[model samples]
Target: MFRWDGGPVAGGFAPAPAADALRQWRSPDGGLWLAAWGAEHRGTYTGWCVDAEAGLVLVADASLYDRDGLQSALGLAGPVLDAPTLLLRGYQRWGEGLPQRLDGDFAFVVCDLRKRCVFAASDPMGMRPLFHRLLPGGGFAFATAPEALAACTGLDARIPESRLLEPLFNAEQLAHFEPEITGIQRLLAAQWLRADARDVQVQRYWTPGQTRPALASTDVDGWVEALRWHLGEAVRKRLADGVRAGVMFSGGLDSSAVLALGCGYVPAGRLQAYSVLDRGNPACPETRAIDRVLAATGVPATCIDVADMQEQAAGALDALAASPRFVSGRNGFLPLFDRMAAASGVDVMMNGIDADALFFYEDLLERQIRAGGYAVALRCARKQDRMAGEAWMVPLVRRLRYTAHLPPVVRNGVRRWRGRASEWPRLHAALLRTDACEALGLRARARRHLALLRRPPPPAGGLPTQTLHGAVNLDGIGRFHARSRHFGVEMRCPFLDRALIDFAAWIPLELRLRNGHLKWILRKAMTPHLPHAVAWRGDKFHPGSHFDRVMLQPVLEQVVRDFHGSGPAIGRWIDRGRFLAAAQRWQAGQIEAVWELKMLLLLEHWLQHNADKVAFGR
Candidate 1:
């Protein structure tokens, strides 16, 4: 991907960047500047400077799997076309329709000196991040990393308090609870942006809202067969020949299914599966299941026991803390895997994340009720129980509480209680400076995000099937990139394929969620291949004690010490008393997980380390 600064020459702009991360280039007259750094992931798609002199600068970070099909569709000559060339050829031939005809995970910018306009677009899931900032005077800068843009432009990078809620409350996926308003304005998935001297425009090229597909049957066999074909194709597309590849196999339905399908496409000798087992927790439930898959597929695996590498893991985590803000605190386990992949010479790692989004159906009862009332809802739920091999009454009662009529307060309370009452960490209101909180409007923003959780399903599509699609792109994929980039590995998620997602959307929910099992259709599809016990396994086991407690406990005092003396940058936002109180509770073992405390530490570390790398504005 290229990081560049550009604006209309008439606007009187000259781009300057501090970091040498990008290769710098300028037009002969010095009117235009470009900085790019890119590498081809697969085939011959070197994504930079197809014809620099022609003022045709194409920067694309892409994994275009169906090169032959796409080249044929775009009518490009020759047997193969690189992603950038494909886009450039498409632009020459079709202009704005280029993005729609291409199918892959990509983010790109094409500078057409002839049109005097810059065109940029992100793939449907935004697999690659594209962030831009309008310069102070009259210019624009874009980069893969938000901080890179900030560093180049010297723009404000102060963490927005409202955006803080995302990392603080939901650490697993630091997903945006609402559309972006502060921080870097990221281009969402399936969107295109065009900017010039006079004006800038952004629009979504694809919307899941309009993506519903009609299916003729609610039968398991029909949907399962379709899913098998789509999922196999998705996995096949993600595999790169001759590249050392690995899968983040956890032996759960998602990971197992990926590993099973992956072996079919990639040679078993070339493919290795990696798993993290609990330290000293020999009774780890996943081991037996993992063994089952290994025996069935003969796919080699290296299981890293968390207990064995405490010191190294701690050091890796410290290195992570010293870097910029990552999406989630739960990523303490990432460094271990990232290092494993790097050392094993695996440049590409596939994950089964978000399989649940497409495979498992949620709020089915709510959608049925919204469409056809109680009789239809109950009938659907009962049918699901029959397929799931379980009792439906209790879950049905649970779903009833979430019907449209219940007051939000009652619904929220019930959900909180059901989710677990004790472990949840409410925001420490007393911690922030009252004036800063008010100025930033964190309270109001938090309330708005909470309200979004209570929003009822839409009538036709239930919840936009795109929720997980957006989430994986916004938080999960970005986080993976941030960590994996350090090791020169590209992480791919087969489940996030646009075709697979569309296929899942087309299937009736009754078929997808059959019996009481989540991803019932997926289980049925795999039953022919994997042992039933491994294929239909219901529970996913997270190994050992959490890495945070294992890694952070030895260093707890240091975290507290750093906060107490964390300087004005941090103290201006977080009150000392509130932080100390939370730390005390965590030390006393009153709380199982101190997400807020971890967030504070991570934020504090990022600010201190990246002081020169980032600046603040609003």
Candidate 2:
């Protein structure tokens, strides 16, 4: 609710008539303060500092200051400062000077008034989000929500067509919209944007370290020890600041590892854990297994019964769709987390989202290809030519099925590949249309193309054949972060730490998957801390069970019907008859590709809603 319009006049901005009642808004002597109702129990707080003399403005999330001493440190300036201080905790940093030194789940903007310039950046992993819009008067405005920016400026609110198609056809585009709204754009992960009257420039402050240093012949033990140390450090850093921190524990290896690492840092009763489950879900046993681990670890944990929260599902989806990102119907489980986080008054929610992708890339690809090859080989052996005409269909069907059974590593790889791969054709076509490819800065495009050209080598060991599994995990992480931010809740994935990822990248495939087990190295390292039952759990619990349950709620049916009637963009590519048939099949308990198809349908609806917001012109 904190509002400010520094357009050379006081109280010039329009009033927030629809602002939530729990909101607090203030523009302090040199800064702006806004707090609003967040998630279910917790509230979100943000602050912005405007230094008129130096022309620098600093904005940040309020929850990031439990231990950084940033508040007190910045408070020393007492309303005015000799220079400018834009310090953010729990966010990614950009640029060389003040930006590179900062880290955590965050994104912020700084306006240098003296230089007539503005700058903004997002976290390295793109966990947090910040979006900007160029106003009709040649000035710009930024906000945490697309709705806020659109409401504040004279901008259109209609959804885009690509928003729908992107998620259905190219799932990774769910991270941010295409065409980026003519005068609006999102700060890319690990990138910074600076704008002045003279010019505007955006630059990447971080990049994945692909050139891995070779592992010394005798450094195997040392490498393991280092990996453990870095993992532990990442967990500990997240636990700092004395703020109430909780884990999205599934009793799986990754979450268990996070819980174990955090156990040493958080006090006995202070550590809270949350899980979601459907009473009749087949994965209930796994949730129970996770309960056993949490009980043994002595951390307080809660398993939210999502089946009871039927009415809240639609509202959750609406909130998620308000952002520029794609809303996968799969995230119906997120509302439970949001409600629990709000009710528990917990601020920081740690998740094990990226562990599988970072560590199990090899295993994922092996599984996919193995499954794909098996299907291919089976068909060949049977002399079944039915698959010949639908070459893409075979892999697509196999890939979708493989997703449900994928280990964390393979899941992550598929999400990443799918996101990047879907963009390949479009990027190529765009480049072909434009003669100034070099002038447009297509280096990232080139890198993606090269990666696609490098055909995945055959698995040397007993690994999965699916090379695209990791991409799936990556997309999930991206979607999770974007949606979490939408509700004002911060979900941090410790295993996705840049340091841990870089180190894991160098780990040879042989060690990643051995003896047909996924994440073997991590499992081995966690043996001393995690119970054997938790450490060696063979099957990954399907979080989608609760999602499926929510999908059956009558409200969701109404939502789907309403979206269809609203002329949703998804209606363009979706065969309404096919979608309706799939929905009926899902309702009859014959859910398979129907759920995925529904997700595509919802994505298309979202795209149609935001069609005009894409910024292709800029």
Candidate 3:
């Protein structure tokens, strides 16, 4: 475990010893690097290995990294290798050829004295964070968290006011830090950076791609079969570790597909499935559906009732504020998952997180619109009413209602010019600007959509679609990875494996959203492996639903009190009467407007609390 002066630190160090040691190690050539924090009992250490022959440095949590595999893979001499080992034995994993090939959540930096270079990298999804500051001297200083570096070096930790505003107007951009913080940036996902005295180079090691095959005839069945093959292989690769892996099942099509594929790799009896259910929630019905799928697959499953443990939700909020990514307000799930994983003795936790963006399905209307098949588009749009209760209709309705709230002129123009040749571009632009995109906190969705539309249609019809989905998936994966780092758990998203993503990219949009259903190809491929009910089921709960009941109530009350209190950031940006009125409306179940307001309130607390520690630069 590595410890620095910022964030939460665990260890047994007196105030004087800890402060002095940390200060000495903050200089450019200071022979120390901070690592991730683990449990409270074990004190963290940061220092360099003196031996020239010391191989790669492996720092990880106790739960994930395998010691025997590390020794074998790294070609160590004996049970007690000469090299110094930071035994985050359970959390960090290293082995010969394993470091490069390993997937899932991790952040690591290996200083190769032999090569006189330091190689650092984070997981493809960026579940772990490593920040580096190029010093005035020749050397570079790095740490697991930015706050740690700031604390050690006496630098400020303040974020830019613009970054604070961006999330209000464009919540999706919260994943990125404000550009004003000089010399501070996150390591990109799937990228490796090497720094030596002479130079530093960063390069991406993986890219997800799919190319449509040139065919004399359109054979949809061939595409479907190929998708299944690649997806199965993806799941198998993730289950490579002999240790048991657990799936975060939701009974939805995406998770069911992952669960089924996982079961195929591990024996049914050995595979463990987990799901979260908020008791008394209307969405709990999905949990029952998940139960049915578990029975059909014969996989052992555990359901964590989140409502039963609401207190943990408060802790999740505080942790999120300390780390400060786009606060999802749904972070309570992290603690819930951790408690379950620790209890189950599970090392790897598989989730269906990236499925939405990777295997995104355009509604039936979108398919026809893309084809310029107006009649078909109209037919599907009208049938939307008849298929109102179907699985795909809810998101579609959300999209429509969200789009309807645009400025009066824009909304009226769209309604009047429906289906006209001259109106196509205008209508498309309006739909792209839906408020749901903003409400759901999709940060750069608009900018990305415009970028995609500017490009000419692909010759083979794969690149454009793949680029769109890949960007969205990468952003979500990046955020998920960040949150996992905050929670001290390694989160694995099976759907994000390069092979599975490529397969999803290649599957035709028509097959993905046939007959008004989303994720059709995935559902069809896993039909045999999953229960019929689960295979056909639709409807997903916004895990953030309980935010209003559990979090917002306390947060709003606190915001009001803090607004009245002196010396908080809330007093700076929030107007007293307006903020109070919004809180009252939110209390009356006007939940749609609560998210951005809640984010602002949280930011206020964070800024006030960290004002002294964080330094802002332009």
Candidate 4:
């Protein structure tokens, strides 16, 4: 936090953040204040740094996976330095271009005394978050989380109703498109911000869509070898020597592979697996998958049977909802991580969130048919169907029905013959109140927003954006961030490693989209050593399949009956009667309104808890 001295609409001032960050520092005149929080992990910032001779004061929330590579690039000799020191020296050496040369998740601010400007940047993947507010005369303040920035002394943190409701316009498009959903400016992935007396500017520094790695021409076997090597290295470098790490073992291909790879780097007791098994759904597919993995690997594992924990977690809901930094995750699981941290001392967690986004499943089979590669498409589909225990003819016929050359009349006939789920726009629209959506134009805006995903994603993606979660473009969905923030534990995702992503980018489209499977190359590379059937399996059993029955029906009933059309913010976009009807329908085991209900519930909690204390402008 910082306050401009003698700038427009400003005087002598000091801006204080609300939360107790790990470290806080202030310049003599109180014109600048720096605060940071970091976990005990490689590339973490322990404290703020000031180089009077170099004319720089730096505060960073960073984790550089390739500190050795960065040090080598900067020509820094002598003993290894920390991430913050490396960032400071890199800024001196390469200036703003330093972000391009660096790898890993980072968000940092450098107050450059020589230039009289402050520079900030987040890593290419946005593994860390950065939010800021810019006032008149280029006076600025920023924090790692939006709520933190809102809490600082300098700005009107009261979010406007219009801004508060903007997210509903494209709630289906989950990440990045409207990162400012909380009504604060977010520095996007690969973006840099520069603020000075003259002006404040935000510019994107790297375009992942345009990045082309050099390994594109390698043969299939060579590509597989390269992927295995990169995957191993990605896991190895991120663990950091002597740092205890664990994986959220879901018994899925990605997490299972991470566990297999991680075992090579750490000892038996050092690496652990944490899983959430729903006691109610004991016979679910994931349970079977988990059984297979446990039978095969025999790795030490702890299962958090959450079907019984609702009563225990009940008291924390009000407090969790009351926080201004409202996170979008299973807050119900917060205690499980705390237990993991307390009992097991596992400080770092490796996640497999990026696999779905990076090793994308493509629509090339349909394209192959259109482009006259029928044999190739059939072969791939056959292999995929065999592995999935489905008949090979299903996808072949479906592909034929969906091919572009099929007339609309024929496609309509096929659709009538075999029912298909509605598109995301229609499905997501059902969640909002009809009157609220029309009045606020969310009905139209949501369609327009979702239509953008109809186009093909860049090479660095997992599924068709047309599919659900196509919006999950290698982004961490606050599960890790929420847990880390709540517990002060370090978290890392080897799959989000820049080098791994780059290696995945260069994989030939044939292998990437082959076998009619999502992340075919990744599975092919890992199956040899993954030890479990999950690597060869295509079905990913989502834990939320039973969430409506287990979680929502009981808890959300009160939220629906209790809420009237009264919130200063929610009522404008969510009609009380209509939203109540939707919630009622949802509680009756209907899932059409899941996203809208969940998001509105989150916002209602935010508004109810924060409206008075948030200091809204009169």
Candidate 5:
């Protein structure tokens, strides 16, 4: 938080903040104010508050997964050290290099009073959250939660329509759009922000390209051997002492792999696992695969029924309304999950957030097409067919379409065709007021943003994989942290560990994905530990399936009623008449539209709840 050097504004700063301000730090000069609040994680150091000199102050909301790795890098040893102390020492030693030298889920700000500038960074995968705002005259404010900055006495807390249109336009690529722009401006993953009195600048400190192995090798078994070591160490690092850690088990390969590997470190009797089961929805049932892990490992598990949480919908909306950050996920069950964690005395939660992106195999054909020409791309496509024990032409055709040999027009035409083919049902045309959308140039702006995703991957980075790192990875992390923080639990992902990412970064794409398989190397590495059914599973659960199955009927009804009548907040951006007709269909049991409608409802509630805090530019 930033404040006036002194005077009435300084005194107005809250002496005791409500739920939003979990911890607080103020500059002695009365020019800056910073705070952290919420369910503080029990074991891991989050840099809740840092001890620093008068001119230099650093506050961090971080949970380092690889503390041992960081300690080894910093040359610290012996007894376990305080998280803040270790963090401050590293920051003081390496400055901006601190992010590169560390591996964890963190977002922190270092204020240089002497230089009159500030430096900020998020974890490589963006597991933690941070937001900043430039004030009217001078000075700036940053916080883990946007609400903290919105609560500032002097800062302009008006809502920006562009922020709302971002997720609407880009779909899942919201985090990749602009590292500095969200509902409020947000820092991108592996990127850092620096601000001075005159200006603010955001720069990338690290990228997957920077970590490509010194010697790239295509040996599959060799790659698997290395992955096993790195992946094991990654899971072990998160098994910190004293805390009762739990895995967010979904019975999928990624989470199952994490659970299997984690059992080696945590004893079966002490092991804990949690899964969100939809007892009511046959379409999205929790697979018996989870039972296999529990039975094999003897790890105790807890299952929560989404059916029980319909009553909490209002409270969830109220929570979403209170925060200024755009909640990108459609999951309506996290609030209940967190409450369960809190009740069960679980402090740290581990998940398999980016295993798919890390081990992406579908992009292999494209990568070969770009680098080794059509012949090479065809060979890979054939290899994929052979591995799958079938003749397949789709991979070959898809690879050829994206090759460098193709004209820009041809490539773009293919992309546009595919994009159109995959386009989800959007809000009805009548739902958006043409005058308002035109005034904001909503369609034009959305087109400009969508075009960015079509550009070729950098020469040094993997195709689509690099794009994943910059785009969805950043957005997903912020959403995860927001949901976790709401219940005061710290979430960690082992697959995102620096060592694992570095290893996965340089391995040949064919080894990562083959024969229509994704994360192929990961499956091979964990085959010994995971069940054959899980290791060989081919299908992925759509992210919205569970939410659609459980909450669609109830949530949609409430949102439709609210949208057509009392919820005029979203009307500022959407066309009310169009939305009303769509809502009618949604109400009449045409539930396929639930996914799109829930998003609008979330946006509507967000706008309505924070109406006073927002100022339209009109």
Candidate 6:
């Protein structure tokens, strides 16, 4: 605990100049030392705050959407306070209840000197990352990004053993494990923490359920219209007053919806689409859809051909080799950010990141079938299939097991007969050592991953589908936010807005996946504004018939080549012979997936680059 009265201090407070972040403002009585750094863009300030009189110092990576509303509620009347100051004032009035009254993507920490307590929280969607560790003597350390936090108190900057323990080659599995960084604990979406001299506590501040009962009562057409209205309002709140805006478009429903709605808010010629054109792949997924959206919307866009993607992966990997700690998928997008910086174009880039996972609840469909017999479920399934452009028999056959629900025994048997126990196939193929699977309990972990996938919707809702999918996809969103900010571009995902996600919870399942389609509700709502090609697109184009294997071949190669130098950090977890064999196949472009490569590379990078910090035998 920090000492207010000059007694013998257990652990002292001071700033590390070498940390290169978190400038300190010392208390008059040396009771606390607060460090803060902030970004000020177009009159919005998100980074730093200190209210000496109130005994609270705030450090945040934030974007407050409803500044006026929050200010009015807090009864503050004056020149607009910076985001951090407004939040501190919110804390002053609401205390730990402050985050509930707030909106937007943010991660913040408030050190209260008078109370001798530290408080920290993140936005419900985890668009911004927050990692911290409570110290033994009630001290604490945190960093928005990992590299800077390595030497701070209460963190271990080494690869977690579970990371090496599990050989993750599946994309979904990799995404699940991606954010389990070494050392500091990442506060998940909707989570907050409090610490004092006595002990520390962490808990969720959000209560999940349909946000608007009135909106939920509306008919299909009425709700669809309401979706459009709510969506436009969401986009408007995210846009800066006079800054240019762009959507990270993929010719998909979610981004298309964002682009369509976002256009209404961004000035003409000021809205752009940052697109990736899948070239050299005959199955070019986005080319046609991109063209249609561009033509229909008449908005300017910058498209990059995959053929023009040259050696950017290598540079990003090399940057990792030079820095310690893990960097997420954002490292792979350095080239895109580079291009944006070169054009000196958009200051804010929006994306459809979580819209895919957040829009619908898969298990809700299963529950619907189980609760109602086949006859009723058949009708509901037909309605969904008809709307989604799918054959009625498809959804019907997949769900027939639920029809035997009259007898619990028969129903259980029928379901068991319909599906095998969920497990990762070829899990051993990822291990270098044959016994590693049994030795590490990898099979059990795989089952848990499957269980996460098959998890039913939370009775209430807080983006159940995404949250239940093992990892909240926070790995991607958090890294994207950190990296974009690193390049001085404010990244916003309107889909991750707490308000929008809450609105999604109330949406009917039939509306979300009509006609064999996903994101059906969003597609229908944006149909008038988006080109039909993009609005009703069936699937996203996967370059090289694979996701990252081809696009990031250079980075993969760099990771594989670096494998020759794998030390105990990697050697302890992965089987060298087995992993290298796969790497050899990957080098020849013969492998379809190499999801484990990035995780290995992250561990290898930290071990090699942070040689001074590593203590394998300690």
TM-score versus the correct structure, for each prediction:
0.81, 0.68, 0.67, 0.78, 0.80, 0.78
lDDT per residue as tens, model 3, 571-596: 54444566666777777877654653
Across residues 1-618, which tens digit of lDDT does each residue of candidate 6 receive? Answer: 244242333333333344444455556666554444443444245556878788778888788888888989889898766688789889889988998889887899887767777899988877777777655544666767654455455455554444444434343344333434454567777888987777679888884443554644438888788778878888888885666777877777778788878877777988888776766666676777877888877888876665555554444445455433345452344435434642575677788877766775435555445545445546555655665455754455365554533455564454444333434344654553446556656566565554444433234332333442235365567656666666557778887777777777677766765565666788888889987767776655533223335445654455556556644455665667766777777776664445556455555554556655444332
Candidate 1 vs candidate 6, lDDT winner: 1
Cα lDDT tens digits, model 2, 273-363, are 8776556664565666676677778887776555565555555455445654555336555645654574576767787877766676534
Q: Could you give candidate 1's per-residue lDDT for residues 165-215 as a string of tens digits?
A: 345545334343232333357877788998766678998887543554455
Per-residue lDDT over 259-323 for candidate 4, one digit per residue giving the tens place of the 0 to 100 score: 88888888778777877666567656666676677666667777755466564344335544534
Clashing pairs in 6: 38-47, 387-514, 387-515, 388-514, 388-515, 388-516, 389-515
Q: Which ten residues in a row have the lowest lDDT in candidate 6?
A: 4-13
Model 1 spans with C-alpha error above 4 angstroms: 1-22, 38-46, 51-55, 157-166, 171-184, 209-215, 371-402, 405-425, 429-441, 451-457, 461-464, 469-473, 560-591, 594-618
Q: Name the top lDDT candidate.
A: 5
lDDT at 434, model 6: 44
- lDDT-better candidate, 3 vs 5: 5
Q: lDDT by residue for model 5 over 254-305, one digit each (tens)?
A: 8888888888897645558877666555554245576677677677887755
Question: Which residue runs does candidate 4 get wrong by more than 4 Å?
Answer: 1-22, 28-30, 37-43, 158-183, 199-203, 209-218, 278-283, 306-344, 361-375, 378-431, 438-441, 444-448, 451-471, 474-483, 559-618
lDDT of 4: 0.62
Q: Give the alpha-carbon lDDT of every model.
A: 0.64, 0.55, 0.53, 0.62, 0.65, 0.62
- Global Cα RMSD, each model: 5.5, 10.0, 9.2, 5.9, 4.9, 5.4
Give the clash total for candidate 6: 7
